[model samples]
Target chain A: MTIATFPPEPPPPPSWTRYLGFSTDAKVIGIQYIVTAFFFFLIGGLLAMVIRGELITPAADLVDRSVYNGIYTMHGTIMLFLFIFPVLNGLNNLLIPTMIGAPDMAFPRLNTAAFWLVPVFGTLLIASFFVPGGPATAGWWSYPPVSIQNPLGHLINGESMWILAVALSGISSIMGAVNFVTTILRMRAPGMGFFRMPVFCWTALAAQSLQLIGLPALTGGAVMLLMDLSFGTSFYRPEGGGDPVLYQHFFWFYSHPAVYVIILPVFGIFSELFPVYSRKPLFGYVYVAVASFIIVGLGLIVWVHHFFSSGVPQWMRDLFMATTMLIAVPTGVKVFAWLGTLWGGKLRLTTPMLFCIGGLVNFVFAGITGVMLATVPIDIHVSNTYFVVGHFHYVIYGAAVMGIFAAVYHWFPKFTGRMPYEGLGKLHCLLTFVGANLNFLPMHPLGLMGMPRRVSSYDPEFAFWNVIASLGAFLLGVSIIPFLLNMLSSWIRGPRATHNPWDAIGLEWLLPSPPPEDNFGEEVPTVISRPYGYGSGEPLVEHQAEIERRLQLQEAAA
Target chain B: MTSTTPLAGSAPASPEAAHGHANHNLTGFIIFLCSESVIFLAFFSGYAILRTSALDWLPPGVEGLEWRTPLVNTAVLISSSGTMVLAEQFKAREKLWLFRGFWLLTMAMGGYFLVGQAVEWSGLAFGFSSGTFGGTFYLLTGFHGLHVATGILLMAIMLVKSFIPGNYTGGEQGVQATSLFWHFVDVIWIILFLLLYVWR
Candidate 1:
């Protein structure tokens, strides 16, 4: 059979205009997603700084209460919807097809449509700040009654716009789920069975499946909320005998699993990086892979834990509490698998490795607190307090964001065809680790002291911790500079990346960095073994020697 | 797990199946329909909860919905599903004219169902803000009607594409996707019918 038909030399890189325009290429779409998401990340970070600035002292001096509400609301909405979700999707678009040795995604046009919806919904979301009511003062959870209130009586108030934007975002994500699930299931390279697939692909499948089943609840709820707010439905309007708590059920049903939808890919990132950095095969590969689906299953039922303080029935609270804690078993399986992978191996403390280790440390902490919060009593005690804030930030920022940074650093070579500056990457990781811990750790004590979250001002007793947290927030803000600089300079004039810079064992590593326009071209490499054969020297793909020879020849010709 | 047969494991994408790509598209489409159905489930659940909990479920003046038009509308919509199946079967057999006739008939039935819904909406005694029951009634039925309209639009597009001479004869995946979507809309209506009309 025909195999290893590498082009004589690499074609010139595609024009920069492709990034701005509608390009169906998965790589372009991936870059577009990443860069756009980072832009919103910066915007969200700025809003966060504003929030921390207001809370620095025990007074509401920097921004007024209404403005503070808008800032924090926008901050959460932008960060979760625009940054974390899109960035992971960008990685999926770039990696899934390449990892499976497909030419491109199964539904390339659908993928493009999904990416474009991000900016549309993002713009509409941010535009809510410009509207009369000053942008969705309700929390990111957007619980009803509060979300349904519109004193301004404007046709397109902030809450309405926010609901519309969120619903549109849900539609975009559902489309993305369809595309990713289809591509993963149907487009694997020859011999890449479900078991032989990389753990990342497994995580992606699990995450997208959650998206398919759970996201529509949120979208439907948002639409009903908008109808109540604008079109005069009583879905959540208690004045008209509507039930607000049912809205809570709908919101948390998706929003709670949404936390997993965001973090599962990060878990996959940890699973991917730990083996490569430690020079070992992933310990308990099948279990780590299977654990993701387990997490998805439990993720669905455990959403009611978010409602323990919202006055759910005691039986529901008990049932959800059990399911919530049970999720930790699968998660712990992954954690132990990573630890086992790292144990007694030649370790590389590269930038990605540092971030992975840091993220793992933070995830373990988050997982403990997650179980704590799952207990109905503890959740009731810390409900709507800064402690809950601390716990999730540990998951969202301390773990997930840090994991995302690790992925960027690890894949920078493959994305841009140039190696990221190691020193700058390390600096970014160090500052981020220090800044995140400082910013979030104080909140735990403040929460235990009964200090509530999402407030502009607090009592004088909370002042000391607030000051330290604000300073940490500013440091976290500064942490972005090194990352932007590294990505910019590396792409411009950093050392040219070899085909497999880290000697990684995946289908993506076999191709040249920033792989060709049509990935794998005519001869799609049939995966022969599992990807994490690190020191075992087991071949990953058939015709390995021929493929390597052709790769070298093409590189030399270029 | 360490090793796998290269060729046999990837048989789905092999060159053997005559409709391999079409099958993948249908798989993706069916999955989309499944996801879409959950949105309707959310609406249905909301209606059920509101209906059961409210002391006075109906509005002041109106006793309840008149089920006659909707029953006929439901029959019209359900019959379209049968026509849709015939259209797809004809396309598979390469009988282009028969496919077009049945496809057009299905679209006409879908349009008729939508018209019937609009008439029923217009005849309703209560506004959308009447109460929890009225709000849910309009929201659920209106949402379902919107889906029916979308399905008709999709079928219209496929019908237009059929005029391209050899579209269906060459095998059109879009036709199957649209039909699947049409059937999904019908299934949602069945549930909505039970909750909104028959259950009372």
Candidate 2:
């Protein structure tokens, strides 16, 4: 075989204009996703505040029923599609290549395409709000029949826009998923075996795989629903011999695993944080990794849990309930493993660590409620109630949102070349923690008292809790102010951060903070030790030794 | 787990290995193909479910969409897949000119197959809005046509890129990815052809 010669020195970094189209540098693409997704997050949160304000009193004071429906609908749509998914995608885009010590994604152009598509679809979805009939009045589920037969059916182009935009978003996700999986599988640095890879990367890989398999059902459902609306097909119209329930089945099939698609990466985020803060290796690396895959596998079978009251057969319902309950086992294993990682170690109480710990508390409550909702009898009672809303917010907002906050604070230095204000971040964390629980915790009671979700008005008796929840919503909005300030101020005025601020072990920190265009200098990393290889009492010595050995090998080879 | 270093003290491997190891671009294509398959698979599954659910197995209204036309389309697609494989083989062997010819053949066959589908679509008595049969048929074939268009565009790009001297060497791996994608499109059509035409 002919031996290939290396180019004497690596070529100069590509121009900025070239980076715009197909740059393989993960950090740049990651920043693109993060900024766009955060913009949507603010829009989604504003929609939530509007919905809460309307429901603060017994009467529908703030908006009409249709307008109220639009608010809640846009809120859920933006949060799920534009906010949470993209945030995770952004995190993975930035960190996965670095964690695994790759120069960039396997396909650079595809990564650019994926990141850019988000803003396009996001603009389409947001613009629907200002269109003729306003944004979609149907819930985010966009269940057909009702969705197909809107009151302003003649005037509303919202449904078409919704489908087109969502389909576009789906395309973006599929591209990102492909890029993530391929990068992880084909581009890992030497010695970074699958088992040795960071848990965050493993979680991201699993989440992306779930996206790969799970999104097609939603795409199929969206197309059928669009046809039912525009083309007059009866894919979901029972009058035309089409079964509406089939739409539910198809929608939930994707949406259910999609819940994991949103949460699994956050789980990885926590997995990374716990060991780092606790100053120990993760207690059970394989357990956490295996649990991530198990969640993906089991996530598909439990979509019927969302529809326990949809008249599915008893045996099928029972099977779904059992599968749903079994999911708790893997989740519980992860919770305990995280606690084990935290036990008996030098715990760091930084803002990121605090947010991660707070995430644990909220997710515990969320998981408990998740198990409760899994029961067939309980789910039937709370199927369309505020309890369901509360349950999901806990998972999405409490677990996923807090996890995003943790990742932002943790990785802010590497991305910006400066450290975030610690005092402001801590303030943000505390206020957010209290605000999130106060906003969502009372809904369990309101749901138990028979308060239906998606209504413009409710009985006077539910007013007190509604008022409290609205107040909490305001507090939550206030809590984000500090975060925004910290982010902006840090970028402008904060001191430059060291490459390894936290003494972290990931390959990302081995390079300069805000890594150069090509990420590494003349040399690319070859993994010398496992991520989270912190030894007790003498971690500095061990890390130095490992670094020196790797540098010596590189020098000899050069 | 083994401590032996694969790249230690050795000159870099051949350009092919370097491209494969360093870039790993094919992995992204494989992953894309996997996702694209699921999208089509979902549509196919919907068709199967609807077919099984229909009272009078095949709907009575629509006609002229017989197995023969689609059968011919299927043959064209399968042959195109063979030509795609040939193109990849030639490109791998550094027969750049031959590779381009096979790609042109595949693209031409793909266009013919797409035109045949449009003709089949026009002859149908039903429209996308008509009923269940209309909905499923248009969706399955419409999405397949979209893939066919994308494949043609990709092939055209590869064909043009082949003429640039330095760009042709590591281009085979990318061609291989496009070939796999073409094969996936063909496989999906086979499933759709069996379900919509032959089974009926």
Candidate 3:
């Protein structure tokens, strides 16, 4: 049998300009999602620094009250909607199809269309600031009455634009969800059954399921709010006998599960990375994969817990609290599975692994807080405080962003066809771990001390920890400079990566780094064996020969 | 788990299934409808709240409307589902002209329902902005109306594609997808009809 060939080196890589325009190719689209999402990350990071800077003292020094609201609102909105979610989507776009052994996404043009909506809405959201109302100052949640109370909600223009931006983004995400679900379900390579697929694919499927079922509720809420503000419709207007709480019910229905939409995909990244770095098959692989689906299912029901403080009747709160707390079971299965994978293995300690390990460490704490907060008593205590903020950031920034960084470090070689500088990557990882803890860890105490979040300033009594958190936030911010430098400097000058630099066994690693257009070149991969198969195998022997042949070809050419 | 043999577990579609179209278009379309139902659920929840909690189903300045015509329109919309099923069957049988005729007939029924809804709305004294009743009524029904319009437009596109020689040969996928959406809209109308007109 003829073996598939890998080119000696990536020949004359595609121009950087492919990143600039419309491309139906999934890789091209993936890059677009990543770069654009990173830009939004920077925007959100700058806003975070401004927030931390303002909170360093009691007074709202940097920006006034309304403006501070906009700043934080934009910070949260950009991070949640624009940055983290799309980055996950981008990573999925880049890797899932390749991992599944499909030529590209099920609907390539639809994928491209979904990607284009990001920029349009991201720009719309950012542009809302320059508009008369100065961006959705009502907060990302845009709790009605407060959101609809101000004509600024209508006339000031920012909240209106925010609603439009969010609604449009929901449409974009729905399109993407349809594509991802269809791709994973229908397009697996021959022999790659559902159970045999990688854990990452399973997580992607679960997240997409949440997106499919959950997002339209947000769309429904946004459409109602839009009409309420724009056409003077009363879907949320109490004077018109409308119930604002109903709107909250609709928004959180999507937004809470949406909390998972951002993280579950990253969780998959952690699952995939741990096994690769540990040189072990994902422990209890079926359990870990099923755990993700469980998270998805539990995620949908627990959204009501966000409103415990909103005067939910006793039975409703109890029901949601039970459901919310139940999520920890599946979550525990994953954490244990991760730990189990790490046990009894030759650990590589790569930068990617470091972030995953660190992220997992933080995730445990976050999960602890998650369970605590799921209780009605504890949640009501910190519901409006920075304690809640600390807990959330621990997961969102600490866990999810850490997973993103790990995925970035892990995939950077494949993406850029070059090795990132190890020293700088390690530095980046260390500073980020310290900074994430420093920035978010202290907020728990501040909130416990009655320092409500979204305040432009806090009392002087809370000043000390705020300073520490601010400094940590700055450290976190500074950590990215090294990452950007590492990627930029390496993409141009870094040594060309071998096909499987980490000796990982996955379908994607079989292809040359920075795979050619159309992904597998010509012949489609027929997947065999269990996912993450590590031992002696036909494909393994063939792949080793191909890599050696390519190395020898490069040697001969030189 | 069928981990040992790939062929048995894998989708039986060869590349000859034509440009990867058969992989999951029908399945994707169905899943999309399920999600769409959730969207309608949000509206239904709001409608249910308005129905039970609100003091009046017909708020101030919104007089009651005759239900007779809307009932007929509901029947018209539901019958379209029947035609849609026929379209799916004809396309699968490769009865091209029969499929086209039924497909157009389905589109016409959808159009008729939309117009019936429009006439009902015009006959009412309330507007979208009137009050909670008017707002929810117009919004929910309007949302459903837009979906019906979208389903018709999709079917219209299919009708055009059906006339082309190579398109329908791809199977009744186009027919199936359109029928799925068309029927889903019809199903939503039953709910909308129940809460909006019948309960009122």
Which scores greater on TM-score, model 1 or model 2?
A: 1
Per-residue C-alpha lDDT of model 2 across residues A5-81, encoded as one tens digit per residue: 33464334333453245344567778768877888989999988899889889999888888888889889999999
Q: What is the TM-score of chain A alone in each candidate?
A: 0.99, 0.93, 0.96
- CA shift of B172, model 2, Å: 0.7
For residues A436-478, write the lDDT of model 3, one tens digit per residue: 9999999988988888988996779999999999999999999
Query: TM-score-based ranking, best first?
Result: 1, 3, 2
After TM-score superposition, the amount by which residue A228's alpha carbon in candidate 3 deviates from its true location, in angstroms, is: 1.2
Q: Can you give the lDDT of residue A220 in candidate 1?
A: 86
Which residue pairs come into collision in candidate 1? Answer: none
Which portions of model 2 miss their true places by more than 4 Å? Answer: A1-24, A150-156, A536-558, B1-21, B56-65, B86-104, B165-167
Per prediction, the TM-score for chain B is 0.85, 0.84, 0.85
lDDT of 1 by residue, B97-133 (tens): 8999999999999999999999998988898899898
* Model 3 misplaced stretches (Cα beyond 4 Å): A1-11, A152-156, A535-558, B1-23, B61-63
**Highest DockQ against the true fold, candidate:** 3
**Ten-residue region with minimum lDDT total, candidate 2 chain B:** B1-10
Interface root mean square deviation per prediction = 8.9, 8.8, 9.1
DockQ of all candidates, in order?
Answer: 0.36, 0.30, 0.38
Best by TM-score: 1
Regions of candidate 1 where Cα sits further than 4 Å from its true position = A3-9, B1-23, B169-171
- Would you give the TM-score of chain B in model 1? 0.85
